[model samples]
Target chain A: MIARLLKKNHSTEYEELLEQIAQGQPLPTDELEDETRPMAQAANWLAQRRAALDPRPGYVRASRQRLVARLQARGGKRPWLHRHWGDIAWWQHPLAHLALVMLLVASAFLSASRLAVASRAWLPGDLLYPLKPMAEQAALLASLTKEGDAQLHIEFAHRRLIEAQSLVFENRYEQLPAAVADFDRHVSQAVILVNQMAGDQQDEARSLATELQQALSGQMGMLMLLTNLTPDASQAEFQRLLMISEDGVSDLRNVLTPDGGDAQHQGWKVTPRVSMHWLGEG
Target chain B: MPDRQHADETRLVQQAQKGDVEAFGQLYEFYAPLVFRFLFSHLDDRLDAEDLTEDVFMRVWEALPGFRARGVPFGGYLFRVARNALYDHYRRNRRRSSDAELNLEWEDNFHPDPAESVPMNIEHGELRASLAKLREDYRTVLTLRFLVGLSTEEIAVAMRRSAGAVRVLQHRALLSLRQELERQESEENDRQTFKEEPLNGV
Candidate 1:
């Protein structure tokens, strides 16, 4: 009975055993029942515990080595790097010069990418890239650059600005999640203006245009990052998740509020996560 | 790859740095699964994971010969590559309209039993396939909690966040895992996963 009790329903016993395991106490063999030994899953449990206890590295490379070996075997015939740079060997080769160039190129690319990832990092210098016009679009939207073709210019600039914003977000490229919070605010403000304009608030459009102008005001230290054509990517990315969070909330809200009734978002409340739609359960 | 495997990796890395596509491909085959595992952890969709895995390998191929192999382990370098790729994927995909985000509620057919053909498990050959069906934070936390076994502090280190954040992540991870585990119970074909105490010298 004791063996049966210990073996069959061993969770409590397992707990005690785990404690013993932690203390480095040896579990008694004869005193324990068969079930006390992991029945079918003893292997996986130990593996999980071992993994938890001491994390191993290199399974990552294990996956790569098989293919890498195949790739290398193919390279034995004609080693490109050896062929090209073989004459210059390590000491004579421009490895230093090349590494320097590579580093500079990588650095510039990554920096530009970081900026391109978010509008917040935009600088006077970056404006020289396709991004300058994005800032200028905000001005154009406000008709700040009512160049001979006003409506056409706003439409063109706004479209381009939206495209730039889309490109940044499209990449989901994250450098520092917080860096883009300002950009998110800017994006949201632009969205709100667009929404209002859609609702025919021409007067309110100017306010949005002005908000965008102020948003792009100071370079905010982007000067240094903007000089590079490319840069080494950082470990993490910047994102303006709040805009998405709010967007999620708005999405649920719209679903809750029946369209064509009260146009105001006040008709129904919505949470950031769950969607409480008026539609019946399927 | 094992800790002992770097000598081989070093050979490949040296060749790859020279823009040997074949050498880089070798590196890809070895690291691809780990990259896929982490990618699956970060992103739910398998196709997306596969795509990102390809991207990470391509980036490695592009950047290898110039890559500095010292100071950082090859795994670290691969991880850096995968992380950059994932960030790019997130920027491209997650920012889309909310409609793009599939609902998280359970489907009647996604039963753990293979016979029932769970939509989530359509992909095969990976233990983590179903886990990848989970939400982003939940999937990551579970991967770290179970697969990586980083203590809360360690997890915080991995995520570059505070321990409190890791704790929060753990809580959420457990909740999501519990739900999925229970959902597995709904399947007729659900069989208990295996385990054994393979203690050293035992």
Candidate 2:
């Protein structure tokens, strides 16, 4: 009952107690009926707050000498490469962040370029990468980590396109279209996988990434598939559709005829030539 | 003036507010131990208390020149700034911590034995954990009255309130502290193999 009374009248009772303490009187026995111990708690609170605001005696002096030279320069505009010097009370210059950020970007670029030119990097994972045709495509893999899955797929597709070029030079149309078809299918599959994963989390940025991944994957897939599977000409008839030479002779003549028959002369490899259809300008 | 120290303290505040670093440093040295004791009681970690003490002076140095030379005692203005800074620091750090992390952060380091020298080394952090649990009124009153050694009149000026109001806050703050202490004691009893330990080692 007294506890409830104290709760109801606690604020007034608090004042009465402080007055009593200040006057050097023990809390009245009636007021002490419910709460006699709130005294030290308030004492502690004030003390703690005070301590946090005041540390060692001369810390201000210590920081003054440290900040004096930097303070002089910041009176106008600060130098870009100088220390951040984070004091808003003195310098409210808006250009501070802009200069700092630009310097950061430029220095980062220079450091990356210098390291790229001067550094010799060896990775333990390089030994495992040569086993896959897709893996053989990424020249940048040995140097960095941020290329992500989409870049990896693009690198692989471009590599397969290079391989198709070799087949075109060799007149290997049958194998060339099949390789293009494989690249198309994988890229399309990767696209559908991303599309299936959209709208999952609250992070719109990540969701947008899924959308981009799906769209690019589909575009890449269609490019490969359309070039290989379009029905304008029969698989063998494509041999006469050679854009490499305007004579429109069969690819075998170029490979077998003595005038141009030297397969090793133009760095050409011997293969069937079904790779004539290219959806892209490449 | 040489004898009373109180009159001298007022003079120092006027000089400190005029950008005298030495005057501010004198106030810091005089009040640092008193502040630490209060922080040590409220927070359980000695290091955090020490850090906040340092931070308080750092902020005082920055804000002192702008501080108005109002007729109220300088200690009240100084501690009021310090108190507000503590709350701001808590608010900022709260955003960076998860629920579990906050619980861990707020864990009290006060032991059953007052003589336990280990935790008092970093008294401020430990006290903050306990202080965070208090109601705002209780926190303000308690901090102003006991910790900062503000008279009721001084607290009145800083809080923009009547001395009666500050006294009431002091009372309510103490009640809350008692309740908090009791609740913690019971909770500690329920935990298995729980032993009293100070968070800050001597």
Candidate 3:
């Protein structure tokens, strides 16, 4: 009965023995019962064979040379794009280079135009609507001068006001807060741009500021029309939009005015007013 | 591999992926012999083994961009590439069966000195016969484990089996090999005794 039980557990015991042997531990034949001794011996023999099976040195050397040569030859055959001189060669051909440049510009302009047209009618929840803000940003960034910058920001502010009204018109109250925030940001960005102008650019800044003020006044009137239509779920966001537009109009008024002898407004300078939330804290 | 060597291999693989032929050459130096031996055991033809080993590395170079060091050890990946190349070789040659095609013979061309060459001996023939008698998976497990000196985990990846399964298979294979060798030894001994006994009677 004892021998039978030990024999029954011998397979598990042999697995353990195999693990030890695999780790290069010597087989403990004295401790192992007869059932696993043959397996242990066989494992040792296999390990011995593993030790003896070394490839000839001459073959390894010759094979290495051949492989290295082949690898080098193949590596040399790769196209100019993979070579070190690839960058220089890429722009060396005058006609091909001109064609490549033309192709890239044409593709970029075509894609941008298509995206703009498709996204023009897209509203807050539409799939391509996100591209609208991104395109506005790209346009804003591409403007090299402060006048263009302020103009782009005013245009984007108008777009946001339109988007917000469309959301209200479409009963998309959940999207109103994002549109309000975007409108406030664009308006603030425009105000900051016009205010940062130097003394020499004050006249230009004043002109841009007047255009922005007109745009904001039109947007404010449109926003007030939205108040009656906006639901309670989006009342807080609509109120925030109204406050932003009121502050924007007031700031523009201050920018457009200067006391005849007041030193502070001589250079078309007035400190920017604290926002409504900040005023509430005060 | 130890952590140090594995780290170095990862670095080399990264460089090779960027078309660094010198770094790939170093990798070939380290693994080429083992790969050649692995193919030789199956091909029994040195030139074929050499060609297939080169083919495997070429394929590896082409596929290097997609190789993720985190997925499998470089050694395991190389062997998998070698095994696939070997299968492709057999397929292209219109072989009947892959297992039946294992023509493992000792390379008699191996020479300690240029003036003399070793010849194939009887023990190698017997060993080859013994290996030939084993099942295909059994033969592969033994060749990869013993001849190639792959760790169990590496063998598992190369064979596409679990480490535990490889261990079990290895254990069974060794035991079976031992039984076959002992049976052959017994028959040889019996024949020797019978021939000597006839001489004694004369």
For model 2, the docking class works out as: incorrect
- Flag regions of model 1 displaced more than 4 Å: A1-240, A243-282, B1-15, B18-23, B40-48, B65-71, B90-100, B103-135, B144-176, B179-202
Model 3, position A173: C-alpha lDDT score: 83
DockQ of each: 0.10, 0.07, 0.09
lDDT per residue for candidate 1 within B88-129, as digits (tens), equals 776566543122454344233223355634532333212343
Candidate 2 lDDT score at position A153 = 49
User: Where does candidate 3 stray beyond 4 Å?
Assistant: A1-33, A76-282, B1-7, B93-124
Tens-place lDDT per residue, model 2, A5-72, is 33444365555555545433433544353334445434433343443333335544554443433333
Q: After superposition, how far is residue B18 of candidate 3 from its true place, in Å?
A: 1.7
Better TM-score candidate (1, 3): 3
Docking class of 3: incorrect
Superior candidate under DockQ, 1 versus 2: 1
- Candidate ranking under lDDT, highest first, comes to 3, 2, 1
Question: Which candidate achieves the best lDDT against the true structure?
Answer: 3
